[model samples]
Target: MERDSQLELYQAVAVRLKEAHARVRSLQVPEGVRMALSRKLLAITAVAKHDLARAARRLDRLMKDLDEGRFPEGD
Candidate 1:
């Protein structure tokens, strides 16, 4: 991607990540589930530091799972 387009994608991913984190925080799920989801989100955030595109895709999958009411299994 061009520099300008990559910057836009990164910004959009950052915004989506913020929204996802907030949504996870607002969920009424059990603490274990919440922590599991939070860990997944944090992992994606770390991935974003090295691979923005992969992170975006991972975020999309996570948000989709959440939207479909698929909370992570407890540890």
Candidate 2:
């Protein structure tokens, strides 16, 4: 996918996850509703693990890019 497209997809997922989190936080709900919401929240919480795995995978790619002498000057 193109970089722009990939970024758009990421943004969409982020918005969805934020909304889900807010839903988990703001409602006074029943036991069943709370249980279901907790499960959904747990799935969102797994994003931290997913992010760590992704960072590990990309560490080499990023290091390679840096070693190739690519740098952005601070403005």
Candidate 3:
């Protein structure tokens, strides 16, 4: 509920996402399926990475605003 807690939650999620992304990148598919499915898998991972990045940026902005004493309009 508070800004500090919210910021910590966002940072924890971002860290987990990054770890998952790295694990996915390091996965090795069987040679037979790798040729057929690699591209699609890579695309999916790319989208996940992009979404995670966007979320991190938004969280960073929110934290900055909180630090500057600029509370959201409604709260």
Candidate 4:
């Protein structure tokens, strides 16, 4: 991808990341579960810094899991 398009994808990823964090924080799950979800989002954010496209795909799957109520089990 060109630099310009990569920049655009990064911007979109940032927005989605922010939304995902908020969604995870707002979840009614237990603290452990919330923390696990938050950790996954953080991992995605870190991945975004290196591979925006891969990060975006991971983020999309995370969002889908959240939407479908497929949360991680609490410890």
Candidate 5:
């Protein structure tokens, strides 16, 4: 129960951090800076999406292991 709670807290923190980063990244800027920021943000979003896809894959693997009774407790 404690571990589950901790995981939830960590997830919440991760979400908040991402949100804060996005907000900061959205700040106004000069035209040149805005263009660069837009490109950089696109790249960052692409990487983030790739990372999220990988995380989903890992979660699916974990679910499969759980279903197969392969993952150890406290893992």
Candidate 6:
């Protein structure tokens, strides 16, 4: 596949990941589980957010590399 097409796909995935992260941030925990499991849930959510952020950063770097003609050959 061509580099431009791969870059577009990366951009699309990054956008979707960002949107999903926003949705996750906007979610409310149900009242039933809020008292007992809230901390655990929040911790898990934090980890997920961190991972998503890392992925987004990597995607941004990839896009930049592609634009600058710095992408490694045979990638």
Evaluated with lDDT, which candidate comes out highest?
A: 1
Instruction: Give candidate 4 regions above 4 Å deviation.
Output: none
Q: Candidate 6 clash total?
A: 0
Clashing pairs in 4: none
Candidate 6 ranges beyond 4 A from true positions: 30-75
In the predicted model 3, the residue pairs found to clash are: none
Candidates by TM-score, descending order:
1, 4, 2, 3, 6, 5
Predicted candidate 5 versus true structure: per-residue lDDT over 1-75, tens digit per residue: 977865665565456446534643564545565455345444544544556444434444433543464523221
**Per-residue lDDT of 7-50 in model 4, one digit per residue for the tens?**
89989999999999888888888999999998899899999888
lDDT of each: 0.95, 0.50, 0.49, 0.92, 0.48, 0.47
RMSD of each: 1.0, 17.3, 16.5, 1.1, 16.3, 16.3
The TM-scores, one per candidate, come to: 0.95, 0.44, 0.39, 0.95, 0.37, 0.38
TM-score of 1: 0.95
Cα distance off (Å), candidate 2, residue 61: 35
Residue-pair clashes, model 1: 0
CA lDDT for candidate 1: 0.95
RMSD of candidate 1 to true structure, Å:
1.0
- Please give the lDDT score for candidate 4: 0.92
lDDT per residue, candidate 6, 11-73, as tens digits? 666575455445434545444433323343344345445564455555555445434645232
TM-score of 5: 0.37
The superposed Cα distance between candidate 6 and the true structure at residue 37, in angstroms, equals 14
Per-model tally of clashing residue pairs:
0, 0, 0, 0, 0, 0
Off by over 4 Å in 2: 44-75
What is the alpha-carbon RMSD of candidate 3 to the true structure? 16.5
Per-residue alpha-carbon lDDT of model 2 for 24-48, expressed as tens digits?
4565655566565556455544653
